[model samples]
Target: MSENTQNAPRPIDIKLHQASRLLEIKFDNNTECMLSCEFLRVYSPSAEVRGHGHGQEVLQVGKEDVNISAILPVGNYAVKLVFTDGHDTGLYSWDYLYDLARNYESLWIEYLGKLSAAGHTRKNLS
Candidate 1:
């Protein structure tokens, strides 16, 4: 857990904008990452989304139209996401969120490239 914590980054502020499908996050430890809702949805930490155990990630599909239904706080370091698709299990920690935010550009581009390579279409997250 300590190693995981150490690898995770820390964010000072996190904002979820449903209107533009954007999750804007700022880290006091010196970084900022503006991530898209679709990006977060596809990269969700839930077992349903990620699969059980390590190296078993299941590629998410049709998340192009997914949205966050609600954001619930979890203790001092986590946030629970209730997706519009009714998924509400993943507990996204502040550190995890920070990492996601910090790596958004690279990850987003990767996601786009992967989608394109797979001939998949992200039809706007509603």
Candidate 2:
């Protein structure tokens, strides 16, 4: 195998648990992560969320109850997640997904901090 191929992380399985609002992904490198739908929605890589450049990320609010409506494959390298709120632009690459999984805790903490800084409180879905 080429060096790039050997080092690149790839998903072996991806499952969306609607009831739990979690997306479970298992990678070929033996890493397994369960990411919340809200997290994914808030951290969407689309321009609408990420913006066109640095320091332009739009703070996502009211996504505590958001869920994945669909997962569409993007070639062999990524998947496009269609969110219930009508967001379907981000193409989540394998590397990006792996990074999200591995850094979930810290990233979530950062997100919470941002929310708090913006004076936004999270409301749980009833």
Candidate 3:
């Protein structure tokens, strides 16, 4: 196997707090990443937002009310998010979480811009 594939993250425990809108992900390697509901919703890996390919992503709107209903494990690499209001198709990978944690400011700004364009506001998805 390639080195890149061998070093991929494998989360051991994933906890989601609805009231706080926080997801505490603990990787097998002991690294932790804290992600917010708005952050996850905005950066969902779903085709609805990621589009079919690069540069075609449709920005999410009114995700302020989006909440994670469940976190379903996908083998050892990712987890499926069951969102409140019954929309669940996003498969969030560990790499994606890391990216979100690292680029929070940019991603947040992007989400805000999309919200403004769509005339939407994110309320606590509690």
Best by TM-score: 2
**What is candidate 1's CA lDDT for residue 125?**
30
Which residue pairs clash in candidate 2? none
lDDT of 3 by residue, 1-126 (tens): 122355666677788988877888887677787787767876878888788988898877666657788988888667888888576787777777666665777878877887778887666532
* Candidate 3 lDDT trough over 10 residues, lowest sum: 1-10
Score each candidate by Cα lDDT.
0.76, 0.90, 0.75
lDDT tens digits, residue span 83-111, model 2: 99999998888878888888899999999
In model 3, where do residues sit more than 4 Å from their true spots? 1-6, 28-30, 117-126
Pairing residues by index, what is the TM-score of model 2?
0.93
lDDT of 2: 0.90
Specify the highest-lDDT model's number: 2
lDDT of 1 by residue, 1-126 (tens): 121666466666878888877777777767876776778888888888778987787677687767787888888778898888887888888866876766777878887887888888777533
lDDT of 3 at 45: 84
Q: Rank the candidates by lDDT, best first.
A: 2, 1, 3
TM-score ranking from best to worst?
A: 2, 1, 3
Task: Give stretches of model 1 more than 4 Å off.
Answer: 1-3, 7-9, 124-126
Clash tally, candidates in order: 0, 0, 1
lDDT for 68 in candidate 1 is 84
